[model samples]
Target: MSKTLTITDNRTGKQYEIPIEHGAIRAMDLRQIKTNADDFGLKTYDPALMNTANCVSRITDIDGDRGVLLYRGYPIEQLAENSDFLETAYLLLSGELPTTAQLNKWKTNVTLHSMLHENVKKFMEGFRYDAHPMGIFLSTVGALSTFYPDAKDIFDEQSRLTQTVRLIAKVPSIAAYAFRHSQGLPYIPPDNELSFTGNFLNMLFRMAELKYEPNPVLERALDVLFILHADHEQNCSTTAMRTIG
Candidate 1:
């Protein structure tokens, strides 16, 4: 049987009926609340959004009360134990795990785009020597829009794929550059031979004398960390980023 909520207006002795949607998860539909607010003179409030569900999603699901977390219907424990960040990313974006060939192709595309624009590198020199890495990273990411005009066409499949590759490829370089600037160290360029995390480590920690080497344990741990942070439905920062997009 379907369920409905009845809200009575004291002034006019009228009532508003709201339908309840029941599924694997139960939700109350509230889209019309604002439209009828004047008629009922009703006030809606949920402090800290304790009981509110603001949006719908097909990504991660978190139930704090139940201590459960799922990403694309797979348990967090299973993903953290069995999947690498790139595989998890493939699942999140495409709603399925990628085949070995697909994963390889995606990784190759990312590797090919790993270098930052030379002009962007020159622009970083203008920042104050004491500037924070995070500040520099934020500014440099914003500056990316100017370098990649093709990224503006979000509706184009190839453009979207290219920008996705660029973002994954470039962010590590940008981060490493920011760190190098903060430390007054010469920037270490990406090594195409290294895996994603390995390359980032090379850029972040390599010195004139010492070369960075990838540690299997450390790389796997970092991959799990990235997978864990891949998504959280309605997370404040994620929501903000979506809204901005």
Candidate 2:
């Protein structure tokens, strides 16, 4: 015979009745019941920091105790060794690896949109030498809405695609510029021939006197770092997005 399970949320005061297989009832257990606040260290509990309830991106899962991170169910170690940043981003956003054809198409799309507008570059030049890079990045991203207001049409797949491409392309440039500005150096244009991570490293470290070539081991390690930082559900930023939305 089939069984039914009922669950209620105290916060929302909502109840759900779910049908289950006959033996599924055996999975229900409520033996551990303790009310003393001391047992759970109530003093250490901070409601402001507790944010596991919100849900957002399906990018990565983090297990703090085990020191493990999985991106779209793929282990971080595997992705770092075998994958690139763009591939990992695609996996996080789309939930799977792109087929060869899809990858080619995606790469082409991103490459085509990599160039930032001249006006935006002029705006960057207006910032003071002492300005923080993160401030510049945030302001520049918000400025994108003004330059391409059509991106606000989030329901359009093409618009979303364009925005995604623009962000992926320009972020490295922005970061490199921020690095250079700290040293009072001019910004460098991106080199299209190189891979995403390779291009970023080149932009940051390339000197007029020396040809920059990224170390493969370092590139792979950086790829792993990006993968590990990709996403965590209900994280601070994710929670802020939820609250804002």
Candidate 3:
């Protein structure tokens, strides 16, 4: 006998039943078996420390020589070509492609919270006129810990969500502010109407005296750039996430 998996489409409010044969189910059950059998009998001397990369979820498996990188199982190239950074982020956290409605709701939540507090802005102004942008950026993010000590709550889902939203929304804003500051110009506010890359371009180049026309070819290229840069497993920054925890 075979079994079926039932799934519902949240956006359209529809349901589906996918049939699975017994042989297919058996294959799936077998795939879950750990292939590295030697570790089964090994004894650990340090109980507090992980013996062999206990942090599997955080590190993405990439066969770079094969041009494949996956967060869990979702393909990076597909995500880069077909999705935006925010939606890709949701995929990273939830382990599934979000429905169109889910994507819209998620984007709206992030866009609405993009602006930083006035006190943070004021603190940024105290940096020396010639300070490097990266220094300012690191210090500003560290300062966030002081403002919301609860940001350290890694295990709390809501806190993690809040911090994720804040980071995604504010990173470009802070970057743009640094560029303008280097030129002795005032910081520009973000335009909620623009997409992530679009807003970054606007913040960096848009001005009252000039009209900025974004080229579609360039926009697509920039989107590709962000997607390519979006995530890499166990890179320096990702490794930092593990260390911080």
| TM of each candidate vs. truth | 0.85, 0.76, 0.72
Which of candidates 1 and 2 is the stronger one according to lDDT?
1
Worst 10 residues of 2 by lDDT: 25-34
Clashes of 3: 0
- What is the C-alpha RMSD, rounded to one decimal, of candidate 1? 3.4
Per-residue error at 163 for model 2, in Å? 1.0
Q: Whole-model lDDT, candidate 3?
A: 0.72
* Angstrom error at residue 6, model 3: 43
By summed lDDT, which 10 consecutive residues of candidate 1 come out lowest? 23-32
Off by over 4 Å in 3: 1-54, 209-213, 237-245
Candidate 1, 133-188: lDDT as tens digits:
99999999989999999989999998997888788789999999999999999888
lDDT of 3 by residue, 192-231 (tens): 8788777778777776744455566776788778766667
Give candidate 1's whole-model lDDT: 0.81
> Which is better, 2 or 3, measured by lDDT?
2
Best by TM-score: 1
